[model samples]
Target: MKQQTKQEILYRFPDGFWWGSATSATQIEGAANEGGKGPNIWDYWYEKEPNRFFNGVGPSVTSDFYHRYKEDIALMKEIGHNSFRLSISWSRLIPGGIGDVNPTAVQFYNNVINELLENEIEPFVTLFHFDMPLAMQELGGWESRDVVDAYARYAKICFELFGDRVKKWFTHNEPIVPVEGGYLYDFHYPNIIDFQRAVQVAYHTIIAHAKAVQVFKQMNIPDGKIGIILNLTPSYPRSSHPADVKAAHIADLFFNRSFLDPAVKGEYPQDLVDLLREYGYLPVTKEGDQKLIKENTVDILGINYYQPRRVKTKEHLPNPEAPFMPDRFFDYYAMPGRKMNPHRGWEIYEKGIYDILMNVKENYGNIECFISENGMGVEGEERFRDEDGMIHDDYRIEFIREHLKWVHKAIQEGANVKGYHVWTFMDNWSWTNAYKNRYGLVAVDLENNRKRTIKKSGYWFKTLVENNGF
Candidate 1:
């Protein structure tokens, strides 16, 4: 008798796996003043000082998604995208962040959502993505409780308008970024160096997210789930020495647990609370703020893993004259012999993804989650294009494959990972980077009428989606 043949096992994912990419409205939509859209922080900042951006480029020079969304949606369908994550521009929908809805903006979003659905693409919508309306910022941004309540109203409008068709909703993306960027660092708008304001802004943002989640639950939309996207940077110590380990633990408490605990476990870390209080930097909170945060937790999570944080115990005391910040607690130590992305100045540690998912699984009750953002950025991609006019981006392909391999392993070990979405779908404008580093599978030809061309990795990703595996 002939020997029986065994079918080979392939790297297949779970049923209904989400294979898509993510983009923010300000980064892709270029109609800054059209469609009845008011200015966001980017718009207002660009108007004030355009030279701060890379190559003097601003958000107004994005990929023109506002007018070319149909073609863009076609490209997404061609790439075998089953889901996509997009943010509805608050300034566009309700100009100035809180007021009557702009009918033109409503029509545009309706068209985009309807087009995606018609093409069999599921929408994972985010209500806030770091582009708060200029009017709201004028009212003290996230630092003021007025802006917080206004954000809650904006979130409610999003649910009432788009919740019926969009099943997955996220309240905020990288909520801590604005705190660090605007208040601690000088990269974003309203650049300031005040730790107390940073603390207050961070607190109010958490409260706004909780209120949004509360409204999402109260709406009782069928087949819908709500969550937030967090860039959970895993902190590692240089060595197992007691001081180093303690430093790393404190780093974790400050960076990860500050938001992770409140978002998932419905309580802030007591150590962090005490630390803030000790410094007299505790944010102002109302009587029922704790109850609001405790009662309104997310149903899912979006983890945007790009890099890891390595630190060692501080070597020397600060000057005691500079502004106070989190770095005062620990020093960032560059790991010797670690892989690095020279273009982005970030360490390319693929195992970081697995570590994040494992942490979520073991400590955070294995809540439903997905890889919301992961990709490589190439600074000078034009040099790689061939005679056929297609850019060969095998490095990005390998980068994603290696990351997904770890993601697959974590899922098999019960990490509750639901999907993998790339950092972006196309080479749109970055905040200050201004396309200095392109991370998209599809290249946007800025010099040639903003033409879109799918790179080699884009086609390879299409196959990966079709096979549901490698």
Candidate 2:
């Protein structure tokens, strides 16, 4: 009788679960200059040097969602998207970051929001998604306090305009990407290599985020919630040795805790502050910043987990004459026996999602959060197309399933996990990657009028959303 009573366990989520994908304005919306839209860093950078982008294919030739958003929204509905995350282009909305609101741009966003509502899809809107208005960059970007003030004003305007209808708002997405890609790595626009300047940029971004939260709270949009989306990469020490442990701690301070602490705990790590001060590389801060940050904390968190960072103790000392860098204290250690994603060369670590959620639950006051972005990017996917003209992307299906299993485990263990949103809904131009890597459930034919077709994983996702479980 006991054996007969046993049954398969169902990994079901709570009611009103959010099921969707995310996309940024610059990556999806073409018509870069239409509808009174000002040039952003991407637009200016492409015009200045097209070769910098992948295959010299700039943002101008994206999926043309500007003219096809209605059709695109319907596709989202068909895919069973109850909620979706979309960033509002600062360049398009305020046109130069601090001027009059463009009526045409306003109308476009209004229509998009209404369409989503009409389709019963909740809109998760982000204010800035790395598409800095070119005009703001001219004034020193985030390095200057003026840009920070302008960003606060822009956040206020967005709340006033759309906060009434759009309850979920995000200040910025992956704020550290600019510091890493632009200043440290030279992968983003206005590329430079300066540790001191990078410190300043990162500091100003925190200030800007806190200020935005303050404004959002003041507006008092009914049931409105504001948060920051951080791409949290957990640091694992190579061994339990003191040196390896110290190296991992430093890396975590530099990458994860830099934003996580202030965003959640409303405080910066004392050790990091001491290190910067000892090195004489501390970024400038103003009076009342401590108070401002403490008083305004996020109501939610969006964690974008792609890969984990593995670090080992440093063997070589840095040259006294060489420039200061984050890697000076440690080096990345590629684990010999780790799962890998050969398609894109990223590590296949599904448990990283559970690790992140558990960390948030244990260390960050159990903040309400979700898997905001997770997906596989496979190039040359066209070869997998069948005679039926449908893509059988089993690799993507497996990737998502493995990750969702961990998510289910986390939720069952009480992680306050809210939902799971993939990296994107459709294949669109990446930042400088262009169309080289495709990470979408729907494939866009780059050559054939940018046609859209659902991949195998998309159909599976629709079923998963409808069933709320596998």
**Global CA lDDT of candidate 1, please?**
0.92
Model 2 residue 350 CA deviation (Å) reads 0.8
lDDT of 2 by residue, 1-470 (tens): 01111133266777888999999999999999799999999999999988988789999859888898998999999999999999999999999899899999889999999999999999999999999999999999999999999999999988888887899999999999999987888899889899999999999999999999999998889999999999999899999999999999999999999999999999999999998999999998999999998998899999998888999999898888877888998999999999888867888889988899999999999999998999989889999999978898999989998899999999999999889999889998898888888998888998899899999888988877877877
How far is 307's C-alpha from truth in model 2 (Å)? 0.8
N/CA/C clash count, model 2: 0
Model 1 over residues 279-394: C-alpha lDDT tens digits? 88889999999999999999999999889999999999976999998988889999989998899999999999999999999999999999999989989999999998999998
Among the numbered candidates, top lDDT falls to: 1
Work out candidate 2's RMSD over C-alphas. 3.1
> Model 2, residue 13: displacement in angstroms?
1.7
